[model samples]
Target: MGGDPVTHGGGAWRAKWWTQGEEPGTTGQWGVWESLGACDGGGGDGGDEEPPAGGFVVSEAQFNQFFPNRNPFYTYSGLVAALDSFPAFATTGSETVQRREAAAFLANVSHETGGLVHIVEQNTANYPHYCDTSQPYGCPAGHDQYYGRGPIQLSWNFNYKAAGDSLGIDLLHNPSLVQNDPAVAWRTALWYWNTQSGPGTMTGHAAMVNGVGFGESIRSINGAIECDGGNPAQVQSRVDKYRNFTGQLGVDPGGNLYC
Candidate 1:
């Protein structure tokens, strides 16, 4: 209730400015996940485990730094959804767990979006720039809503529509709902976090540290096998952010449990 626990790990992704098209990567990169369709048994299965009873603490300045200029759209529900869907990732009751999972999740996001909040490429609004106009809703203009809206940045018209349908909101008509309704945005994020495809049945977090190719894992989720946004260098940058934020908080920043 104080400051969201999820952001506890988001810092890692903010370490470096994830500039797209950059190369050579950074040092000690966390790297994107490349799922061989097998659970490596690194992070234990967390279906039966309970969430960390004690939550992590954060100062106002610190919280704002991580979520800078952001509004509280989903709040507690987003946290709950994140934990409920991926129980295994909620183990951070202690510093170790928090640090590991946080690192994994942030790293994954960085890889997917080139470390920057992406613009809606293939949607009704911003279609033609990134899509073929001949197709239905293939070419719209402008970086419309649903352009990487959620934590994982759900994109594309079908994805936005499907996420809206699951959450009982029509993002297609009012794509701004992702930004306007906090709950809607958070639900979309949780949806992406829970889905498992390209690299077998694993959360996006697992997909990253597990060595699933960053772009490939995201493409699976986006239903765009050709989507090359999930570059590995970006994933490493996010991991860098996670490490820095953890150090600033003086906590493990690994799993669900507080340090």
Candidate 2:
């Protein structure tokens, strides 16, 4: 996994709120709501391009095109699907909210997935060998390492089985499918993000990354909370980055994360 794209780019640094002074508003309440404005441009038919019924919309190809060399494995279409579907987790009417959430969510996803192009194939070495190292399931007698797969990188036989059941894909028996199919992998990621819970809302994954403990804080989501390779110093590093970003805006700088 040394050369793995997801772990390479962005390394493991995000921004945090300032600890020395007054912090910003709440983490997952008003600010996010304000960002999610009304759907209608004053009021209209909702439009054709409007995301299908409960779905949202985004240009996955365009997102990928933005980082061509970084991500070249996952399909542009699959990225788009994940982006679009991810919003439904927030709410049906909150298209704006969904979009805002999606923006924040993608930041973390990009960091974790090494962009959207190569995530599926990046770390999907462990498959079909669900049993413990000592047991080895029904694997080919000598096989042992059964790591994980996809963007959020679904792992563990239990999780794979759960993801497959919810998404109707059968990942336990066919773990490799996550790497083989971008849509399957993307859906699994979306499912995890939408369903998981924690200190701060998982709605803004990047925000959580910058604000909380990775495993203890983010493990509610389906993926392992190992922070890729980030530690507390690295977490603070990300906080510094986001703080710098917020600093340019002249808004109130937030406080240090408790975690």
Candidate 3:
């Protein structure tokens, strides 16, 4: 998964906090929340403007080539739309760094979702385990509703609450939005990528932008279970994808490839 299974702390809640009257980043007025129709390359509220590839290191054609069998729900337009919510993601540092970060993020995402084949977690039997009633907020969305969804396969009630609070979506109460909304799904994945560090010492964005390398990004995602020989096969899987993606982007996959 793009994020660790454990609950995060106050940093994510405070990073994007806004006053009551201020608009959240993902709203239609903010231009980050595009309609699914637009994401699907059809007409929608996003207008006739084609999905832009200028700012992002990965172009639409490159993205399609990277995940040729990706699910229709994980739209390239949706990912481009979500970029507005985190301007620094994959855009930080030099061109090589930017491309490396993009490759790293997509590599982990591809692993988590099985080349973008699965939307929600396939293990339905583990659904109910995601809810932790200890949190005072409780699971307003039913115990099983928060089971892993989106590109990162975001699971758990507190995670939903934190991600929703940061992105201005009520994911805790409407966890299905991750699966139902394409833009929201990509935003959540970017949210975890740019903000939360998971079990590592730094965010995935930091690892790439700061020259810490791709292995650190893996550590930030599922290190507790996969890093330091915990699961070398999984680590290698992520590293192989990172290398493949970086190669596809015509960039070098820097050192420290395995966590």
Candidate 4:
């Protein structure tokens, strides 16, 4: 296939060529390129290009296999698009570590959204409780708008504000974006995975990268409500999914499978 045109130092033009049928922008250092220094007078026509899949360890086919009954709204492309926001997600540590991290993440996501079937929280009764008026910013999007949404079920007015601030999306005021835009929804989940520790001692990303096991990742996400016999069934559900996903990825689920 033809390459994508890229401009480098001193106006030097280059065509990014792929070998072995690899997708563009997905190969990282594995890509081959021909450096066509300096543009002359001739114009080169470039074909329409598809967005990069971010070269994640998990492919679209694998993701589909993981969530066959997923809601159409939770698209694979959206998840790929959101990967740029968190480069270190599944790219850290060894190949096994990388696959494990991806599996762990998707496992948690599957549990949270019920195999990616639900886009937003099902219960409407808890909507008003997500709004904490005591916060200085309060709930600009109204008290009931902050109900759980996206892969991680991000909720609460304060969480919306913090996620918005971190992602530069103003989710505090436009909380619906989490449910409306698939990329935004996935980004919120990634934001929580890579940044927030929740009730745990470390972020989910840290837990996997540091070899702290998948259980710690669950702890980081919802230990306050699920860990230490708080809800063994819930914790086991996540662990079961993690093991299944890791098996699909041909990797061990690793130690500390429970929080």
Name the candidate that leads on lDDT.
4
Q: Per-residue lDDT of 1-259 in model 2, one digit per residue for the tens?
A: 1211111011111113222331222222322111111122212221112122333323222233234555445665675565555545434333333333444344345545655545543433454454454433433322332345676666565666667787777666677777778888778777766655533454334434344323322334322333444355544443343333222222223343223
- Which model, 3 or 4, shows the larger lDDT? 4
Q: Tell me, what's the RMSD of every candidate?
A: 15.5, 14.0, 13.8, 10.1
What digit string (tens of lDDT, one per residue) describes model 3 on residues 123-168? 9999999999999999887988879999989988999999999999
* Candidate 3: RMSD to truth: 13.8
- What lDDT would candidate 3 get against the real structure? 0.80
Q: How does each model score on lDDT?
A: 0.43, 0.43, 0.80, 0.82
Error of 2 at 125 (Å): 9.0
Candidates, ranked, TM-score: 4, 3, 2, 1
Tens digits of per-residue lDDT for model 1 on 1-259? 1211112222222223343432211222442211111111113322112222333222233433444334354344444544544455524344544444444454444444444244222245453233223446532333343355655666656666666676677766667666555556556665666554533355554544444423333434442433344454443455466665555444543332110
List residue ranges in candidate 1 displaced over 4 A: 1-62, 68-95, 106-146, 196-201, 208-233, 248-259
lDDT, model 2, position 126: 50
Error of 4 at 65 (Å): 0.5
TM-score of each: 0.47, 0.52, 0.80, 0.81
The local distance difference test score of model 4 is: 0.82
Error of 1 at 158 (Å): 1.9
Locate the minimum summed-lDDT window of 10 residues in model 4: 41-50
Which candidate, 3 or 4, has the higher TM-score? 4
